[model samples]
Target: MTKLLITLLSFCFIQCQGQTKKNETDEEKKTRQEAIIKEHVYDCADKIHYTTQMYEYQKCLDEGIKKDSTIAYLWQQKAMPYYKARKYSVGKPFLDKAVQYDEKRWLSYRAFMKCIFSKDYKGVIEDFETCIKKYGNSYEMDHTYSFYIGLSYLQLNEFEKAAKIFKQDIEEQSQRLGEGHFLDLFYYGISKYEQQKWEEAIVQFDKSLQQYPEFSDAEFYKAICLMRMGKKEEASLLLVKAKKDVEKGYTINEDNAIYETYPYKVRW
Candidate 1:
């Protein structure tokens, strides 16, 4: 009948099954419980997606959380809408709950949100540093933990520190993936640009543009670097190209960019 009752019955059924299998390993029992929790948590997915009201979406998540308060997915789902709406304070408690229940899964994500959405650079560094200690250079939202840590330093105007971290990140990615991510190159460029290392910044920007030829932000910053070097004519031509590309929607295209402006993304 009701979703909560369904979840309870499903959970009970799994428990009973576990009882019959006295030889069930602890890992196997944990896996079964997690599978049941995931099914129960995802049962509200359709309502969460289609509901026109925030309260209705939250109601679905709240019901799941009530059925099993340990389900971190329920807490994350409850928090996300508020964060998307820029209601960070309202969403934070629920997000904190998610981290509390499943730090391994949610901690780095929380750090990314802090860096991008809340602009909490200090908190971003702390969380990402903690994640790195535990997970060893793990990725979140498609970038390494060190990438956000570098972005945090950039935001804090610790330009040299940012540049150092980005360099390490780029070298590691290059070693493992055979190339650095385009955005990582772009931000590494930004770090050098902040330090007035015009030629060095342009080199990183050129690398980024080589990967993503129409990357408007890379072009924009490269143009600025040229201007700083007194190459005004070349800078002017690049700026024109950057403007046209931006008008054609070829800017920083990260998924979260749809929700929030990325650091150093040029408006024009």
Candidate 2:
């Protein structure tokens, strides 16, 4: 541990020791100590964000990990820059350690990275399935666990499974949050499009567009569906609009889309 961390922890111990109450219960004392440690960890973490140098950042995380090897956030912090830089192989070991320390918190995030950054669709499916079994259909990075599973199945060309999972996710979200996310609806449409179910795909694409007006991927795919159904004139008009919207930067706006292309995100 660094001298600064050592000193801060020592000061916290001394301060907490001085605050002990005569009638304090064992659980109360434990809670108090945990709070002090958490605050000290946050204080150490605050300094990490001020530096952009990778070595310095990793060094800071190393110090915190040394102080408490059980804290998963330190390991995750150490791994993020590597993944963001497309160095997934270099980052995976650190991320695995984070998962080891806190599976519930970091497993879904690791699955998300595997889905988007590493292109490990099988691994993504396995990790997300594990997450769903343990946590029961949760959200990670703004999408449901099933959403990533659906995306992974799409990448693996398992369109039927992808569409099934997407439909379940849409229904669950509709019941829980009043509506499904636009990307969920859009990707469901892509699954239908892949299956060449033109009319069914068009219905999903239209619903997605209702949620996100001028969503280029939905518009583009809907136009393709129209053309497939022999509505050539209407398809041509919508295709032109889709191309113009995409040109104006109206594409997948997910935060990680800045780092990697999402599955089926239209570029043209």
Candidate 3:
């Protein structure tokens, strides 16, 4: 009985020793990976600061994320370069991880906004839906989210979806600033134009002009829509007027409105 007890004790000791060694090896591997991740992250960030070449920096950060999922900020940082580089496919994944960790909501939103500029309409819709669910009530959040949602749908050729949101935006603006607001009409006209609802677009532009007559770009787009609707005479008149205004230094580069926010100047 004594010999049997000694054997049992010996077996238990061996098993425990093996378990400890395995655990230690796993921890050592994890630590090594973390160190590697940290080095790559710093290198990438430095490169981004110096060169502004986001694609190369993003490559380094992507490797870091694969090794150490704990570094949430790395994911967000990784996305910036991809976004600026116009690599939406690569950027979306990292930004997706950043949001997954729940550490950088605002950064994630900004990254997603950049994704919209890359013309990733599906990504914009997916990310915005989550953002609205997560932070719907904040005014900034609502405006930013809704605007992107509408913009994304517009890009995706989902005009009906954009039109619905623009309609809601108009109603919201009306309640806040009262009716006949130029901004409300302009945005509504934008939505109508996206939908190829040319007549409605013309009406909205006319309403905007009623409030802000010097909105020459609105006049230009209105003319384009009128031309699309086979109203060549009306379009010609508006074009002549727009050309005169441009010569008078009165025309606005409708595309330049959001130059600061968007990396690329939106042509339409």
Candidate 4:
């Protein structure tokens, strides 16, 4: 960790020295600053660890970014430590630059950082909607984008809106992902369950369990649907199977509702 810290410090020193170029144009100066900021950011990123030294290293990158404020990716680099620490309060302001500059190939995957880490579901939906409205269909090509939006709506108890998006994705895909992602089906099932459509929710859960056989949560949800619809025997059997899965330590999305808590694991 000490070596990594020294390496990043040395990189910053080198950049400060190099920026003293003679008779550089204004644009050239900006470009040079951007390059220097990126250098320090990458150096810090490479050295990141769960250590105090690494936090100091990241703070070094953040300072460089703040000093060279025009560079979008620099701000993103500033946010790296916060993202890793699940500290969205400190990170989101920095990530704002990546969004503003449209250097967002990775940011597209990460809007959920706000939803999962900040409990900012409404903000997530509004931001995605605004961006998607501006960028249109191309902005939402990734399945995860749709999932996050729908899941946020679910969190808000807005079942109809959530169902609209999930149904579109599930029904419109060109090819099946064999059984498909369990969370995809799970969220869709949840939308139905929230709407009190017991039979439909059970069908979705059944399809999920068919593909993701060991998904205890899916079985548990299915049991709930059956129990709701007065199929006590069937519900009891499914609940027993789900209990065994829990005892054997299976896990899935929508388990503890921590994403609603404004602090979360980076992944769903």
Candidate 5:
């Protein structure tokens, strides 16, 4: 009876192995077919559509999905053309599906940025956290994810938490960029500004100016801090410099004038 039971278990294991092999074969075939469908879709869009509208892209995707719904990369690729064309609303749904099918880290980043563009800060925060979990921590990681997370929280009016996170991000950036990175100073200044730490913001703006003397935004913020601190004369001079530099096209960026309480023709 024991020998019979052992024989029965061996047969079941062999059957399961056979079924696994068959599943693997089918999966491989599906992958190959999806590749063919993606190539055809690209070709079809190129031949048939002069404008890569979302509907046209969706048609191509439908064709690919009909061939192999499991092809997540095909969905991702379909979204790419629309994203490149700046049809974000059209691409966003497909990108969401692509994540559902395959949650790759880079794709998560793409989705996070898409959500940011879409003004879905909550979704952006979630995706950014997922990215950090999958990709681990690093300089770009801290600057990109943590900074954005703090921004999202600030936008959502979680100021205390946002301030703490932003400070942590600035600290991480200082460690990574040796406290002298211009962008690091920008972020630090912005973080302090968000927290209403005008004095600290001024110090950070100064650091930024020391690194890049013509840093327009830093100068603008310094003027703002001066205005907040009731030093109108100094603020006015800085604002004048900002306006002159801007009018001369020495600083074409609109942020300097707009943020400095100076009138500008262009608003960003």
Candidate 6:
């Protein structure tokens, strides 16, 4: 309605200017204004739109899909926001259609999403390999393709492979983003801790703490590592402090996150 008012007002101005010259009738002016409105509507309908807000982005994509269901890219485009918003159930059908029409573009990503939603760590390792082979180490999100593959390996108890990937990721992200980046330290530490590399895990946790002193999960894990190394008193102190972080609502991340239990199992 706001758009209509603006366009209508502009049309009225233009029509009034040439009223004497063009001698247009009321019906003729109405018809021309209607054509202008129709053109604006069509332009809006065909536009490739984007929005940062997830719900708004969903609405925009819905309108686009309604206008032309045959457009494969629109299906792919629509799936992304839903997945990012953690609405995988809503996103799944769109992903299916996206790959159905545009296999080359959507296949690897679609497979990755399915693996994640299914919590199939082994399948994540397989699909992430496919994703990297097709698209390389693309960092379209918080965790890179390598990160997901490494975490999958960890889930499968492939500690050696997990450590190798986790170490390399830690180093690379550190070089690019700098040392003590929380995720790099957390994952690397967890991989080491799983391997019973107690001292090494403590070092990673300490590094993480240097960056974020109140990091609850890191403190919790560090205390566990210390306890294993026979530092009971220090470990007890850290446990007390770590509990405070939880009291303040800091949570441990399940699976690949260092915040969870030492072995890091998948949580749905």
RMSD of each: 6.0, 6.5, 8.9, 9.0, 9.2, 12.6
Runs with alpha carbons beyond 4 Å of true place in candidate 3: 1-71, 103-111, 137-143, 177-187, 194-196, 207-217, 228-234, 240-268
Question: In model 4, which residue pairs have backbone atoms overlapping below 3 Å?
Answer: none
Best first by lDDT, ranked: 1, 2, 6, 4, 3, 5
In order, the Cα lDDT scores of the candidates are: 0.88, 0.87, 0.65, 0.68, 0.65, 0.69
What lDDT tens digits, residue by residue, belong to model 3 across residues 1-268? Answer: 9999999999999999768646777677667656766688765555466245555666777677766665667777776555655567776777767777763355436534554446566766776676667766223323445666666776667778877886776676667668634654666687788768888988888988888786766788898898998999999998888777656655433332233233112233
Residues 88-118, model 1: lDDT tens digits: 9998999999999999999998999999999
List the candidate 2 regions with Cα displacement exceeding 4 Å. 1-52
How does each model score on TM-score?
A: 0.86, 0.83, 0.58, 0.72, 0.66, 0.62
Q: How far is 7's C-alpha from truth in model 3 (Å)?
A: 27
Best by lDDT: 1
**What digit string (tens of lDDT, one per residue) describes model 5 on residues 60-127?**
66777876676677677676666656578887877777777777634555644443445567876787
- The list of candidate 5 runs beyond 4 A from truth reads 1-53, 80-90, 138-143, 179-184, 210-213, 244-268
**Ranked candidates (TM-score, high to low):** 1, 2, 4, 5, 6, 3
- Compute the lDDT of residue 243 as modeled in candidate 2: 90
Q: Which ranges of candidate 1 are over 4 A from the true structure?
A: 1-41, 49-51
Better of 1 and 3 by TM-score: 1
Poorest lDDT segment (10 consecutive residues) of candidate 5? 259-268
TM-score for model 1?
Answer: 0.86
If both were scored by lDDT, which would come out higher, candidate 3 or candidate 4?
A: 4
For candidate 4, write residues 1-268 as lDDT tens digits: 9999999999988887656654678798778886776567666655655346666776667677656666666666667557666677788887877777653453553465666666678877876666566554333323456667887888888999998887766664425443445567777888998899998988888777777787777788788788888999999998888888867756554433433432211222
Q: Give the local distance difference test score of model 4.
A: 0.68
Best by TM-score: 1
